[model samples]
Target chain A: MDLSPIWLTLKLAAITTSLLFIVGLPIAWWLSKGRSFFKTIVEAIITMPLVLPPSVLGFYLLLAFSPQHGLGKLLQDTFDTQFVFSFKGLVLASFIYSMPFMTGPIKSALQQLPVSLTQASYALGKTQWQTFKSVLVPNIKPSLLTAIVLTFAHTLGEFGVVLMIGGNIPGVTRVASIAVYDSVERMDYAAANTYSLILFSITFVMVISVFVFNKYQAKSPLE
Target chain B: MIDLSIEKRLKAYRGQQILKISHQFTTGSITKIYGPSGAGKTTLLKTIAGLVYPEKGKIVVDSQTWLDTDNNINLPPQKRMPGFVFQDYALFPNMSVLAHLQYATNDMEWIKRLLLLGKLDTLTDHKPIHLSGGQQQRLAVLRALAIKPKLILMDEPFSALDPDMKTELIAELKLLFKELAATVLIVSHNPQELEGLTDGDLYIP
Candidate 1:
């Protein structure tokens, strides 16, 4: 088991989760608060990555981020950087692939909430942004935690999208899951087994952590 | 002072027709809304809090326009400053008693007041879910009060409590509101039930 691949997986997960949180928060907020004809369409599109075949997502993502497409060419021409076969490309792919995992819990939790939580803050003469940052975020703690863990874990185990966009460029886009596949193909079962076990352990820990936190919340003093 | 003349069509799925009701709350006094199960009590309270938008009308609280459907203006809940406690509404699951109060303003003195008000001094460190139902109801009051809004809206705040706890809460509220001169609006099935808490004015529908 090469340590580089392991580190790369962790890095990918971190970058993807951080990026998603920045954009996903507003999107989830809108879904919970607003009603529009396009709202359902937007939600379905966001969740498409979850249900879509990983390979199909990878294929479209590869084309979308490549220099051939408008977005990809714009990024390259403007920033003097290419996304394909790069760490950035891997992050972008992981972000799209695991978006639903990040947004689903957050949206549901926000919806389940009463406007009272945020209202309470505003009534105290606080600004809306301040209220969201302080009151809403802290109140929806478990949902945000769940979103982070699921997105990170999902990004860590990602294969298809990374395979298409990242192209297995060692030391750059060669994540642990891909390395595991490469190892098995090369008849290195021990290395593959090690990588597999690590991924499993990481995911197992996240699931267990969620359960423990929920149980703990159920016993909170402010019930 | 809060004044709302809002008309909202509430779509109820439970065999009740769409409801269109318009009401107003005047300034500087406790207003109790008494109605049967299907009456517009909760809707009225929530509208004043900006949680629900009325179909038509104007809402002016303390000279600020909150909602004017004719003028096409509706402020979201985050823009309104009203302490609200819906029936059985609990504090956030992720926060402890102290953390929940932190939203009101990280002011330690006010937190202490709330802790003492609800007899929650020892439970300040505990999470909301860990408390008993009675404790939760008490915390709800303290949480709403901690915000120090000009007005407070409670939807059947005492409905679920045992008689002893309800009377104790009402007695406690009388002292608190009279001392602060706060405007507390309550919605209940039995408008006359909470005599100890009110100033002896009940508006029944």
Candidate 2:
């Protein structure tokens, strides 16, 4: 069996998860703490991908990533990088598709935390960033772990959006899900089963570990 | 000295009322803030600490203008850096007793002394969940004092402690407050608890 698709899928998941963490931390923190009128609108927009049909999001992203469009044209002109049918395009599409998976748990975790914890840190002369890093992050470790695992697994299994945006370009964008689809289309049941088994095993382990870790955290005195 | 004249519109079940207060507290003094429930006692302390904003007010702390609504110069809480002990003892669940104090200050000797003052030296490695109510309250107070802040605001700081523990802790705190020359404002429902420790009183109606 060709392992290129598996390697590509892993690379995409790793990159997307890392990017989501860097970008999602502040967004989740704001959604948890901010009281602005625009917060509702922003939250709705972020969560839209979760409810919308994957085909619909993929279709729109395809247009937005077209070189003729505003965002796509701006990137093309500024950096001379074509987003359509490229690895970069797939990364951007996956990031959007998996955003809520990344941010929802984090935001809820932060909201569930007592406001006094952050306030106490502030009163102790710690800056907002310092408090977030030292106090808020450590306390919400379980939720953060949940967020990371969910986003990675969700991105790894994405099908419709990856199809529309990434167009099955062999090593470039032919990730595991797309590889499974290709195998089935070619009537290669053995190849399809091989890919499916691996995906299922990995995801099962990740989800089970998350639950075990959560149970351990619950039993621990500190958490 | 800390001087403040503030007015905040508070929404109550009955209706809306303005909490208007003007006062000055001398340096190295302990003031007890006594008031009925819904009288804005906690709000007053929060405003001083820059946690809550007063609609109209000027707060001067140690000759420095911390808040001036007229001038639009309100400092944030980190800059104010006044030690605040929440009514619920907002100890971090992930941090041990020693970690809580260490988060506020890097001075090892100060942390050691603070642990002794709170009688938590033995439980330095314990988290708040493992601590009893009185131990948690004492940890909160010790964490606040760890910063050696010039101004300290405590809301119901002794509600959980037993009488013997309260008496012992208060006596030691009185000496510690003097040594640091800190101004303290304590809000308590039972005014009798702080009768001997407090040098001044502010009744909020």
Candidate 3:
């Protein structure tokens, strides 16, 4: 049983989760502010991934990044980057696939905070960025942790998008989910079962930890 | 001295009501504001602090134009830099009694003085959640004072404190306000709370 697929899957999940955390915070913060038609449209687009089938997202990403097409052609000409059927494509696909998981909790947490918290910080002469970092972000720690974990777990379980854009290539795009499917197709029951169990156990542990942590937080006097 | 004239449209239950005010506050004066509910007392404070922008207003603080809708100049809250104590206390649940002051300024001596003034020096490490309502309210007041600001706006700041505690704290705060030469605007539902402390009075109908 080759372990390359498992390592690749872990790497993809780590990279995708890290990038999503950095990108999602600002997006969530902006969205959590006063609502508008433009913000509603952007939020709808970001949230579409949660309800839309992963294969639909994968299909669109493939069309958008195919080297023979407009955007893909421009990228190929300018940056010499090929997204389709590559690790980069897998990472990109996972971003769209797992974005809602990264932004949902954070946005809601931010919205639930008292308006006076920000106002108090501002009245104290703290800049917006300073208040966000020192006050807003610190207060949203639990939700932030939940967002990171859910994004990582969701990325690890990604199968449809990876299949559509990132063709199963050993040591590159052949992540655990793809490997499990390949094993099953080859009638390799033992390998399929092993990979399935590993993925299932890891995700279960992560989800359980989130529940436990949140429960502990609920019981604490300080929020 | 601060000269402020502002008008804001508020969404009252009975159609819309406009809040209009034109007032001057002398430097180092403490003014008590009293009004019925929905009269926009808090909104007035927020507008002055730059938390809320009035539809038409001019706020000139010590010759500095903080807001002038006619001139289209509006300084943000950070630039205005007034100290404010919110009605809800608005203490950071994650920060200790000391961290709140530390976030405002790095003056160790000032911080120590504020801690002692609020009588929260012994509870420096305690978060807002652990403090009693009075303690939390005092901490909010202390956090506002930590900046040693030229202006302080408070909304129902002593509502949570017992009468005796309120009196003692007010007495101490009066001397401190004089020492710092800070002007203050306090919105109170109870007029008696700030009877002797305020030199001026503003009543909103």
Candidate 4:
């Protein structure tokens, strides 16, 4: 059985999880502050992926970045990048598909923190950025780890979105999930079973690690 | 001298109650703020520390305009640094006792002094989660003073301490506050808790 698909899947999951972490942190922090009409709308849009069908998101993403018209045309004309059937397209799709997993836990943990933690930091002459980096982020380590692992595992399991946007290109767009589907269609049961078993084990380990870490984190009086 | 006049709308158990106060604090003086429950005692401390925004107010601290709502000049909490010992301690669970003071200031000697004052020198490596209630309270007070702030706002700093420990700590803090020339505003339900330490008193009715 070919192993390129497994490597590609790992690469995609790593990149997607890292990018989402950098981008999702500030968004989650902003959303946790309080509720406004604008924040509600933004959160709704971000959370839509969890409820919306993957096929629908994939279809829209393909059309929007088809390199034929609209945003796709704009990108094609300026940066000369195609995001429809490339590895880049898969990353973009994974971003939209797995975003809620990354932000949900983080946002809730941030909201759960006592307001006095922030006030105490500010009272010590620390700026808002300092307070967030030193006080807020450190306190939410367990939740952050959970978010990262869940996002990684979710990206690894993505099939419908990848199938729609990233077609079966041997070394480029064909991830482990897509490879498993391809093997079944060609009557390659052995290869399909191998891919399925690998994904199952990896995801199992990641999820179990999250539960263990959370349980081990010491409980605080303030929490 | 700190001159403060502020009005804020508070959500009380009964309904809406307006917290109105106009007072001046002499430099290096310790003032005890006593009031009944839901009298906005904590709110008043937060407002002075710039943690809470008053609807209409002016806070002039030692000739510095900390807040002037009419003039639209309000310094952020970072700009108006004040040592605040929260009622709940608000200690960082992830940081050790030493780390808390180090975060507030780079003065190693000051940190050592504060550790001794709070009698937490041996537990410098312990996190808040590992400390007892009284130990956590002392850490909170020590962390606040780590910055050696000109203004100190404490909300029941000795609530968890035993009577003997409370008395001893208060006496040490009184001398330290005088040495640092820090103005202190303490809120407590029990007036006798701070009996002789405070030179002035502000009663909110």
lDDT of each: 0.78, 0.92, 0.92, 0.94
**Model 2 lDDT per residue over B48-151, tens place:** 99999899999998889999999999999999998899998889999999999989999999999999999999999999999999999999999999999999
lDDT digits (tens) for residues A64-138 of candidate 1 = 878976888998899988889899888888888889988888888788777666655555567867867766777
lDDT winner, 3 or 4: 4
Tens digits of per-residue lDDT for model 2, A20-125: 9999989999899967779999999999999999889889998987988698899899989987899998899999999999899999889989988998998999
Once fitted onto the true fold, the runs of candidate 4 whose alpha carbons sit more than 4 angstroms away are A218-223
Off by over 4 Å in 2: A67-80, A217-223
Docking class of 3: high
Query: Which scores better on lDDT, 1 or 2?
Result: 2
Q: For residues B3-116, could you state the per-residue lDDT of candidate 3 as single tens digits?
A: 999999998989999999999999999999998999999999999999999999999999999999999999999998888999999999889999999999999999999999
For B1-205, candidate 4 gives per-residue lDDT tens digits of 9999999999999889999999999999999999899999999999999989999999999999999999999999998889999999999888999999999999999999999999999999999989999999999999999998899999999999999999999999999999989999999988998988999999998
Highest-lDDT candidate: 4
Q: Against the true chain A, what TM-score does chain A of candidate 3 give? A: 0.95
Of 2 and 3, the candidate ahead on TM-score is 3
lDDT value, residue A113 of candidate 3: 91
Better of 2 and 3 by DockQ: 3
